[model samples]
Target: MNMHIKVTTDDKDRALLAAIQDGLPLCERPFAEIGKVTNMSEEQVIARIEHMRQQGIISRFGLVLQHRPLGYRANAMVVWNVPDQEVDEAAKIITAHDFVTLCYCRARRAPVWQFNLYCMIHGQQRSIVEQQIETIKSAGLAPYPSKTLFSLRRFKQTGARFSTTPENERRLG
Candidate 1:
């Protein structure tokens, strides 16, 4: 939830941050366009981005896709209960499938919550997604215990953004 990267910036950095935060243009020469706006060369822009990431001024850089707009209507977060000894291996296997977009291991709140490994799957329809999951399950997706939590609605989907406020303008939660 902390969007602002804890790093100092100057006037020259304003245009650079603006250019990137707005998103790089979807083209072969994205850096060139950004450089034109920032008055920096393509190499300079790329270098600065790399420097920002290294300095923790930027955490990530990648495309932000809108899955719903792309015809993927059904989306589910599949949680699985894998044994503590095999969770790592199970996670690795789950992450290998094309349908599984995100897969990671989480803590097991035993006696109350037992699922540990989680993955996300998407498809054009709910049945398709379920079928895909069954295929994976038949291929030993969980092999332990699992459940699927389909998203009934979407509240929000977004990526990180740099703070524009001055040091004095930030409000505490």
Candidate 2:
């Protein structure tokens, strides 16, 4: 019996992967266009994509859009004062919600801003996202008072790039 071999790659694989990373074309024959460059048939291009996904090399494939371009102008970083015991559970609930885009537990800072559960929400107006934060506050998960630090200005919003490379030191700007 001739079993199918698992998909593996060489120099060409890196090039094909780079093409996929760059962004797939949005046209009537997107695969055909990619095939022209990779020297693979349209079917091969599609098959490779499937193989990449199955191998866990690709987490997802879709358009990367700027929220502001889509009319979502405001971005807010809201925080909550969740009890130590319930913080993990509360975070799980918050992260699961569709409206809560970002959630993390930071060390409690005190009277000035004691909220530890942080979340970021983007919307058309400040009030809309603010109300969402209020809803979360009233949810009773946060036993302590909470505060939100809304973004006064948006300097930059960039898409993330996934890589397997390692560096001794890296910084975010």
Candidate 3:
């Protein structure tokens, strides 16, 4: 999709993106702290973030949960081979399930790979996650082909960085 998120020339925009690259502060008002650095009000920080999200510049913005620390062990990614016409409905159904943590509608690869809709199911045990998948499969998913991918190990987990290097003007890193 050709999304046009106006590239602000103001250094404050760069500063704001850079400051929040690591994370938003865990406090009463994190944006206020960001405002202090960017010389923007808390409202301004929130507005800019919302604008970015609206423009699809940032796919998602939120806290990064450390599932293991919170006693969540089974991290399974379930992908469903839903027809493009029905993928949206399938995503809605998948996300409605309490056990489904994250849901996305991605592009479908041809003949070799067909599944597009995906959701993550997290649980304390593999069996629990599997059970949840079974429940999800019954919810308008009996017709669709699906599979669960269990993560053997997390290779990397990092936040997206918006680079403002001179060479790149419109692209985000």
Candidate 4:
């Protein structure tokens, strides 16, 4: 069966979305800071976010890390060629490590690109990240063929954009 859900947003909801579309404030009470801007209580901000999530208006909330500024200069995307039957187990093992920041599966194009699972490791130095990868390989994943592609440059990373109207821009400004 195929089903599609449409999310409707009002002005108040737009205001809330505008406030958070960039990124939440970095502080003890981020929602309270947002509440101050939107003229809503902290409880109200929490309730609206929850309601929006339930209604499918907000799919997810994520964190974007500025790794380089925090001394994590060595970041590598490790790709693994795991068999189809063992992809899940391989992913679980990779994600269990503390240094493994991200892990997910992707489709492989045969005869060209064969990697099916990918994970990221971030560290202050290249040797540390390499050691972490070695640790991961020691943890029952040594049999899989893998490649580590170190990041050469950092890119601008931000959250999803929801509002572009002038009024929303003014509110954000």
Best by lDDT: 4
Tell me the lDDT of model 4 at 111: 79
Q: How well does model 3 score by local distance difference test? A: 0.80
Model 4, global lDDT: 0.85
**Cα RMSD to native, each candidate?**
5.8, 8.2, 4.2, 6.0
Q: 59-142 in candidate 3: lDDT tens per residue?
A: 788867788779787999999888888977887788888888888877878887788988998889999898889888888887
lDDT for 55 (candidate 2): 62
Candidate 4 has what TM-score?
0.69
Worst 10 residues of 2 by lDDT: 164-173
The better-scoring model by TM-score among 3 and 4 is 3
**Candidate with better lDDT, 2 vs 3:** 3
Q: For every model in order, what is the number of clashing pairs?
A: 0, 0, 0, 0
Instruction: Score every model by TM-score.
Output: 0.67, 0.61, 0.73, 0.69
lDDT of 2 by residue, 51-93 (tens): 7777655556677777777888788887777778887778776
TM-score of 2: 0.61
- lDDT score at residue 20, model 2, on the 0-100 scale: 62
Q: Against the unseen true structure, what C-alpha lDDT does each candidate score?
A: 0.78, 0.70, 0.80, 0.85
- Highest TM-score among the candidates is held by which one? 3
User: Under the 3 Å rule for N, CA and C atoms, how many clashes does model 4 have?
Assistant: 0
Model 4 spans with C-alpha error above 4 angstroms: 1-15, 25-43, 51-64, 163-173
